[model samples]
Target: MGFLQQKNSADDSIVARIATLVLRLILVVAIPLIAFAVLYAGFIFLRDGNAPKWVITAVAIIWGVGGVAALFWIFNWIVELFSDTWRARLQPFVFVGPALAILAWYLAIPVGRTFYISLFDRDGPGTGQFIGLANYATVFTDRLMREAFRNNIFLWIIFAVPLTVGFGLLVAVLADRSRFERTAKALIFLPMAISFVGAGVIWNFIYVVRPPDTEQIGLLNAIIVNLGGTPRFWPAHTAIAPWNNLFLVIIVAWLQSGYAMVLFSAAIKGVPVEILEAARVDGASEIEVFFKIMIPTILGTIITVTTTVVIFTLKIFDVVWVMTGGQFGTGVIATQFYRQSFIARNAGLGAAIAIVLLIAVIPVMIYNLRQFREQEAF
Candidate 1:
């Protein structure tokens, strides 16, 4: 009787484990399916409903965040239901799966599709000739494209990047020494709060010109008038060609300076105070200490900041679109892409330009990843 009882007990224990395993599997599958159904329904409602804009926005935000959170929770809990050995093997993939899926769907797939479309002629992917490298040849050889590349590389990048980074570094250093560091940083960083289009609009008022003797409504024109100077159309006239481009570059610099300042400030703050004191002890002036000690210490952050800004400058569009509509020699690569793709309806050429831009960004991205990995190691 005792032997039979012990055997039965062992069988019962196995049954319970099997039941638990089945329950865990069921929960994993069922939870996600139900969540997906609900999410689909909500998306449809949001798409079709005549609800108040704010109401739709609020619902979308809540559903988006809550749904993702719940899905992650369900997945993690299911993973945790496994034995220690299984859990360890599965947890990383479970947590990382969603992000991988998103990147594959949103980034990798789109890039591949864009490249595929680039091979076709103006009618785009559905019905266009496979032009081989002809579109790319045109991209390089075209007049407007050539001008766009020149403006992007020289005026937008060469001029704006240094000004933004330099001004940011200067502000970061000065703010660090001041008692009102936070306040000063806040004020300087305010430009970053405004959207690029908004900044363009604000600066437009400053650059807006009037008749030479008329009441100058533009702040810049007013100042010029008061100071016994003249206000020309600031974006259109300086010496005819690329000088107008400089004003557009200035807008980008102004907008991005705050971004650079924030990054530089954090990096500057992270420098070991002892090193600065030691440099001073070694007869290094403030200038020498800044250039030698402080800069070297935060070189990684500097590279990161510069690369980030360079990427942004490469893709600049809204500011130029809003202010000059890519007129008056202000067009860059992005604006040129917009003109080709949407404006001119030259889909093939646009795709080639896009591919070129992507190629340009790829090296910078790889370098940035390397820098990030090195920093992560530390």
Candidate 2:
């Protein structure tokens, strides 16, 4: 009787363990389906519902914020069901999965699709014939494209970068010594709050031209006329050609200087005061101290600022679009892409132009990324 009882007890324990495992497997599949289905329904409602705008917006905000939290909570609960070793390993990936999926959908997929589209004509193979590399060839061979490359690579990069960086460094150095540093920095940084399009519009009044006898409405023309100079078309003067590109770029400098100033100021402040004192004690002039000590100390920040501006200049569109609409030799790569894509309706060519811009930016991006990794390693 004792032997029979022992065997029965061991069988019962095994049966219970098997039951728990089966239940867990079922829940792992069922819980996610239920949760995901509910989320999908909310998405459908948001997409197709005829609800009031405010109602939809409120729902969207709640759903976006709460839904993500709930999903995380649910996944976290699921993770708890696993053994300790597996749970620790899986949790990080579980949380990061959603973000990675989003980036793949939004960024990676589009780039791949754009590359595919670039290989064909205006339309895909459904209507437009396949023309491999023809669009890309046009990008290099076209006169307008060459001019745009010149403006963006040679002119804008050369001129706009130095003006913004130098002016910012100068301001940062000066402002550090000033009594009302905060107020002055705020005023200089204020222009960035305005939209790029708005900045373009504001500057338009400053550059507008009228007949010499007419009231000079433009700020520049008004000043020029008041000083006995003639009112000339500032932005649209194609006779002078690419010089007008520099004029447009000066506006970018004015807007971006504050950004550079803030970074430079932070970097400059971080330099050891002892070093500056030592240089001064050694009979070095203020200029020598700045060039020898201050510059080398903040050299990293300068490179960061330069690369950032280069990226911005490569993708520059809003100001140019608003100011001249790429007319009269002001077309950069971005403007040319816009003109080809939308206005000219040459989709393949436009995509090619965009890819070219992407290619131009990638080297700068790689350099910055490598710098970031090096910093992290350090």
Candidate 3:
């Protein structure tokens, strides 16, 4: 035992020395590289070719270099005070610093701003009067705002849940056995590659409108026109807006189905062959085995996927924004937040809407947590 301990200690000592050398070398290379980038940017400015942009670029590079240098210096100082053993332990942050800085700058700051906006009457331009709890109250009371909230809920339940689950299960099951399974999955999953804005633009043709006298270029309208039906404005019609919203939901489903299928397929493959064979031996139908055995066995996965889709639905914005611009009573919470803050120039109301969205995500998150805990227990 003493011999084994001695060997392990020797290995650890060797590893620690290697780590320290690597970290020190990285700091030496990175500091100079960042300095070179800033110097080159300065040279670009001196040449009078987009100098101001180059100056801004140089400033960013300088900030990055300075930050990296300061961190390395502090790390070395701490190591000297503590010991070289501790310096080796601090090496991982040499690679992780940029990611941490980005997260702090972009994600952390925006979240803080949103929270601050929720508390005040922000409107038009500058910081307006602080109105505590007033924005939250307005969210519940205002009729249009209430409708927008209801629409989001409706989308979450009716669209996000069924589409994410059903499409995932369907595609996964269908692709389980087939000569062209890979090709079919590749085709089905292709939509996932398209951006939200791009998807919205593509679907725009599907819901396009044209006058009866003119040629029908819209896909759906052209089909209707050929069927001897009158030309109709799809989004403009109040009776059709909610259904039109479903078209937008279809885009989200198309994008997310690939994600769900990938997860559920893995879960399905992990099912024990013995259990499946036992069910087959008992003369169980494939359908029965799937629903009664397979679905129940993978219930945890189903719940997780549903909750993830629910979060996405709650935070949906771009497709709706590009499609209807929150008109025809089809405005959801996310788009409404943007519209209120930027378009309507009512930052307080926008902040209120954003707060409402934050509250709305809470229940779904709790449900997700419960699912995770249940899975962990098992």
Candidate 4:
């Protein structure tokens, strides 16, 4: 009975503390707002056919600065004084509540809306009707959409994985502790610092075309012409344009290679030197040591790097968007989503594409998390 009474007393104390803190918070916010309202009302009442301009200016200055000061003072006072254990628990919500609300309002709500719209046959406007799997069906069945999806899959399988992993591994191995490591890394990482749109524009200049009779201005065309090959319209030719997409992929690879290198180099260094010396005593070739020893040791890191690149590849949009605008068969999923939703005004189709992207990303993310957890286990 005594213990029960103690528990009841504690609950009542917590409730009272909560009530007091809430009242303090209300007063903190309300005082400045009420003052501003009262001052504005007085300003309105005292307006006798435009009294002296200085008087009006003084009133405005007083209310504006005074309101801000009062708000700052009250908020700080509440944070300093009323922030006991109950208030501390509530205080974080005070700060984070608006951000959480805004995130739900903007990001979470839109993502949910996109998923909902994927189920309907809506363009940018009214929902024409419920069309369960029709939009997803059209995404696969429609020629351009199908081609875009194929190209996106190709980007991930053919380009994104190799460029980010193979080249990154190669560079990391080559540049590790080399004389020009810092300079090499800086040059490689420079492209990543450029915005996607900016990198696309730079590559656009490289892939520029001139008439056959005209002097080639594009670097690639100029090189080809100087080598006695015909100067072709690089961006226009569908046959060659997909390979040109690889060139854009190169820019991204160049930027991301440094990141991969930094990670792998750290992993490589973590390999016990004793293991390398033991392999050397066994007469393993340097190449064999790298392939059999270093790589096996860093398999987890390699998988982590590869999966990270895969996610980026799945979402590759800006480069493709800026350079090709989903034209010449260089479309990836993200760009396709934008093209469908905004350009084609097909929200349903766009949402389907987004869902496909989400599906693709989720597994890769899960794999990445698993790899990291396994590495931690090791």
C-alpha positional error of residue 279 in candidate 1 after TM-score superposition, expressed in Å: 3.9
Give per-residue CA lDDT, model 3, range 1-378, as digits (tens).
454322324347767779766766665555445645665665566566555877867765776667557655665565457454454454445555445655766676766677777777755225577788788888888877887877788864577779878999998888986778789888888888898889888888777888898999989889989999887757556777567567677778888999899888888888898999999999999999999999999998998888788888888888888888878878888887887888877777787787677777879868768778989964
- Candidate 4 — what's its lDDT? 0.74
Q: Rate the local accuracy (lDDT) of all candidates.
A: 0.85, 0.85, 0.75, 0.74
List where candidate 1 sits over 4 angstroms from the true fold.
Answer: 1-38, 70-94, 227-229, 372-378
Give the least accurate 10-residue stretch of model 1, judged by summed lDDT. Answer: 3-12
What is the per-residue lDDT of model 1 for residues 82-130, given as tens digits with 9 covering 90 to 100?
8664565456656665666567667989888888888989998778889
> How displaced is residue 244 in candidate 3, in Å?
2.9
Instruction: Point out the higher-scoring one by TM-score: 3 or 4.
Output: 4
Clash totals for all candidate models? 0, 0, 1, 0
For candidate 2, write residues 1-378 as lDDT tens digits: 454332323344666567645654544444445556777889898989898999999998898778767877887898788765445445555666666656766788878778877898987556777899899999999999999999998889999999999999999999999999999999998887999999998999799998888898889999998898878877888878889898889999999999999999999999999999998999999999999999999999999899899899888899989999988999999999999889899889999998888788788878878879989964
Model 4 lDDT tens row, 100-133: 6557666778777877889877553364567888
List of clashing residue pairs for candidate 1? none
Let me know the TM-score candidate 1 reaches against the reference structure: 0.82
Candidate 3 residue spans exceeding 4 A from truth: 1-48, 51-105, 108-113, 123-127, 363-378
